[model samples]
Target: MGELAPTVAFLTGAPTQGRIGVGWRTLRGLLGRPAETPTLTVAEVDTHLGDVATTSGSGSAARRSELLSHLLARATSAEQDFLLRLLTGELRQGALEGVMIEAIATATGVPGDLVRRAVMLSGGLAETAAAAASGGREALLAFRLELGRPVRPMLASPAESLDQAVEGIAEPIVEYKLDGARIQVHRDGDEVHVYTRTLREVTRQVAELADLVRGLPCASVVLDGETLALTDDGRPRPFQETMSRFGSTREEQVKALLLRPYFFDCLHLDGTDLLDASLRERREALHRVAGEHVIPGEVAPSDPAALLESSLDAGHEGVMVKDPDTPYAAGRRGRAWLKVKPSHTLDLVVLAAEWGHGRRTGYLSNLHLGARDPDGGEPIMVGKTFKGLTDELLEWQTRRFPELQRGSDDWTVHLRPELVVEIELDGVQTSTRYPGGVALRFARVLRYRPDKEAADADTIDAVTAMLRG
Candidate 1:
């Protein structure tokens, strides 16, 4: 598996193919083949994993992948495959979280509910397990929300219809769903930080957003919301424009496209933690502090269709119907909140494309759609589709996508997640192969959304939400 890229590079006219353009190719050539003699031990392999985990500040991108690749080349083919999967975080062993929690309970003699709660609160199963096993029940109970640390954002399931969502929750608070990037603003005194949904610190990129948070009327606060770039007319710009600013490393470029934050839920305020607070409480706090910055929402809408219409007319994505009394359930797609949209379309990143067949030959036909990871990692592959392509699109993609190529094989060309495409899909289903555990069903390309970035793509939670509805 480590050789996949180096081999493709050689076949596809890569520069300095003999060296893999890094160190790994030479290391592999030196190792020759898996030896009959067992010189390397399991401990030696484990040591490499630990070393890679700790080593940092090494220069250049290719050097880093090659650094790990060189360590991996010493293993046998099967071991190399396992190591590759582990490195990519795609090692699916079919281990259930529920089962792991039960094992933690059995091993620690702590209550299962306590262990589960600690895992949810801490957002680290391994750490939770270690603490439970060593310190017992008290340690698990003591887990609390930290001030600067980001808690997993609560997720919502999709609603088949507004009526279905309203029916599920008697009275729903509907808020317009802005098409933008999720931002978690944390402020302590004058210190302000901004994070993406994946928990990546982007404070430096969105400095204007941090300044806005610093002006909030609270000593310390943690606000969960969305930020989007707006045009001169005060309308939200294309998602691509928003991401260009959000992901920009250059200060001047980011300054050119300032992001405006709309606070929705307040997780913490005035040195008091509100993570356990209900949506009603959070909304009240948000309104009290944010004032004009609070997202425009309607209470107990008499006409659901009318509300959805108003949201769409305002150029928003859709309406989110949330139960007021439900507590903030971090890291969970609970039934407490439901989202209703006009159509089942998602902004997905193009991970790769397969060569077309027959009349479509020489064109990039099939597309691999990926959703954003909440924990700030690589986009996870959900599924592939070749439907809904015009001849113009096929020709354009054939000529265009190779410019963004990362790696390639005979049948497929892997790409960096630079291009975002709008996709219409039936829904999602459970899948063992995809890291998201759900795959798009009947997915078809709508068009390439040049205005959106990979960071603006819909999340894996959004895909999984379709499974419930």
Candidate 2:
């Protein structure tokens, strides 16, 4: 417990990638032999984290870092890794980030709200609090403050259907799920900061938006909004096009794409926290602050059927049905917000596979998908997708995929097209990348279909019909 305190604190103050990377490295160093990797069961870690959270500011950043450094200086490599996992809040095999925060609160005996508020403002956990509770204030002063800490974007849980969202709210406002990027705008007097979904500083990427926001009606404010790239015809451009425009380093190329800022919620207006206010009140505040920058949309009746129809007519992904009674619940996936997208599934065959990068390294995880033929027996390759896979899935595939491997290398593993997988795709588009003359866009692995054989997968004709529809 003594050693664990400081490591967790240091990690809370470190950059997201740096904290995780350094923690992993420290863990490996402690373990001496890689085979003796230290593993902390979720139950065990969760218990201690909960204690730390409740322990009266014991999880503060300065204290946690001091405790971590003190402990790491004396720990075996394996012990260090074990401690690192606990501090970085990456202990579980299928854990959500929110769960980790809960464990931290439980460990320190600190209030979850205090921990969350500290983390959100500091952009990481405050290990110093934990240290102060354990090692005293002098120990906390040894740790330094790191700026621009990145935190995971707050996520929302999916609703069963549009009807589900309307049951709880009286008047629902339907917003387009723009196939664009999310931007968090923070303003302090004349200074402004723009952050991406992953909390990366993207101020330079959307300089035009920053200038426009500077002229906004508020003095000190924070806004949550979307930056969309619209086509010349006033339609939303393809997501890939928007990504390319943002990723482009050339000023001329970036300027060619027209980006519009659409404000959705006003988090802070003139030093008041509107997050706890109802959606109706927040909407009023957002409109007041945004003025012309507000998205050209209407607050519709709380009818799921009508909202769904309107969303389809607008060619948007789907309507976001939000609770009019709830306040802003950041970093928490509550029932207050729900996204209903019209999606379908297709069973496809594996054409090839690729090794994963970063945390997924050493696993043949990415899959190339193909559809079968109804008229003939041949399969046509459509597209490839790698997202939506869990660590358990990666490990399972790494072991099971060897039997299906046709060719192998450290970076890639070509398969024999023997396995079938069910995949969810947002839509299909004409593409020269695949032999079928079309490709599945935004394809995600829903599940591996062992109950059905490869021959039972969806046919190319079926996919073609879907594209036509």
Candidate 3:
């Protein structure tokens, strides 16, 4: 049990791919060795009942404290850490939730696809299937689960360009790439609760939202939506500012953020599980119950060029090309839905570098890039990105970046501005952090450009022009 601490530490401190592999490997070892276990099914774990022993609020504080103290005393430090990680859902050590489903399937002698489907439709965990397989159908079906919790809908890795998605999907619905937090709204009777993807209850955190949702015309409902902090002119506020409000301790400050909810889909309404329905049906349901507060919209067309033009004109992320007839596939990175975003590349100078973690721990990984000021002749930081680096590229950076290093640390190697890289960015936003009072959004490395000098990089004027035009 004590040996599991390193794995827990690995998961909690650095949930990178490498660390997750280590954690899963550790779990695999544990699963291989039999021991006394709880009778709860994998569904129970998915429903987050595994941690109820610690989080249950029935006992007095002192009594609960004593129980916790005794429990901690019997366990090794490693076991304690592992338990904490499991309870908190911070088991980040790089193993994806999908891999865990595979492991559970293997352990239970159930087909991985069956287990995956059950988990997806039920919005439970791999452990639920494991329990069902181990404990039988009765054990798995005992737990009551509700709909509307936005299960991790299948996602695609970012495409090369908006045109790629257009070419792939026949029809696309371009929606706003809102700078906001994703929320799953569940309404039972008049009571409404908002839960993050991790199942954290944020009901109290957004009281006004709860109030607004109470007015939604439905006896029972589950909806997927984004909550954005809006500016006076009706544009989204900064992402960091939105996150700050999310993490704010003051209730008043949170309410002051002026979160506006935008419903994207209707997952459940009037006791129906719409997960099996088509996107068109879901959209129809959304429009029916959403009312005035919910932004009314739908899929535009099957043509890529038309979709792209409409999305850009509407000031949205390029477009999300979804399969109209496909069933909702959750917690899987399937091709049922695709996103298209306009590619805006800039030749930017590397302003600073940060140390990598997990797999690339020994290398300088994340690079902060900047564009030359239009008037001041100084470099203004636009964005920071670590994506798009291959392992070979990482090794090359580790070896070459140090040659220009101004300072060194275990994690990062700071270097003077010398390298020029062509970067792809999603869009621009007004920011207080950058010297130019603006920043780039969703910036990614395209490639290092030896042909372009720092002097030849895109200037702030060009960036501003892109934003304007």
Which candidate wins on TM-score? 1
Residue lDDT tens for model 2, 1-469: 5445444533332222233323333333444333334454433444444444433454464544443454455455665655555444333211223444566667666666655555554554445345445644343433331223333344444454677655656666767665567778887777877877656677777777778888888787778877778877777875556655556557786679867887778777887867568878888989888987776445756455766777667666676767667766555446676667677567798877888888878887788888865433346899999977878778988898775555677677876555778788876888899977889978898767543445456667657656654
lDDT of each: 0.72, 0.63, 0.60
Task: Give model 2's TM-score versus the native structure.
Answer: 0.58
Q: Per-candidate TM vs. native?
A: 0.73, 0.58, 0.58
Pairs that clash in candidate 1: 240-451, 240-452
Top-lDDT candidate index: 1
Give the C-alpha miss distance for residue 102 in model 1, angstroms: 5.3
1-469: candidate 1 lDDT, tens digit per residue:
2333222222222211111222323333334354343455544554554454445564644455655666655667665644444332232211134456677788779998788777666755566776776689998988987767676677667678888888866668888888888888888999988878756678888888888888888898888888888888878887767877755779788767878888789988887778778888888888888888888787788887888888798788888888988877654446688888888988788999999999998999899888876554678889999999999889989998786666899999988666789898888899998777888888998778654456557778778878885
lDDT at residue 453 of model 3 (Cα atoms): 43
Task: Report the C-alpha lDDT of model 3 over 1-469, residue by residue, as the tens digit.
Answer: 2223223223322211121212222332233222234343323222232232344445544453444444444445555555445432234222234455666567666667666666655554533543555564454444333754445444433444556554555555545444356777888888888866444567877877887778887888888877778888776675446555555448779757878888877888888978778877887898899866555334655555665676566554455656666666664245566655676667788877788889888777899788865342446787788998878778888788775555666656665555778788777888888776678888888777653345446667667655653
For candidate 1, what is the lDDT? 0.72
Sort every candidate by lDDT, greatest first. Answer: 1, 2, 3
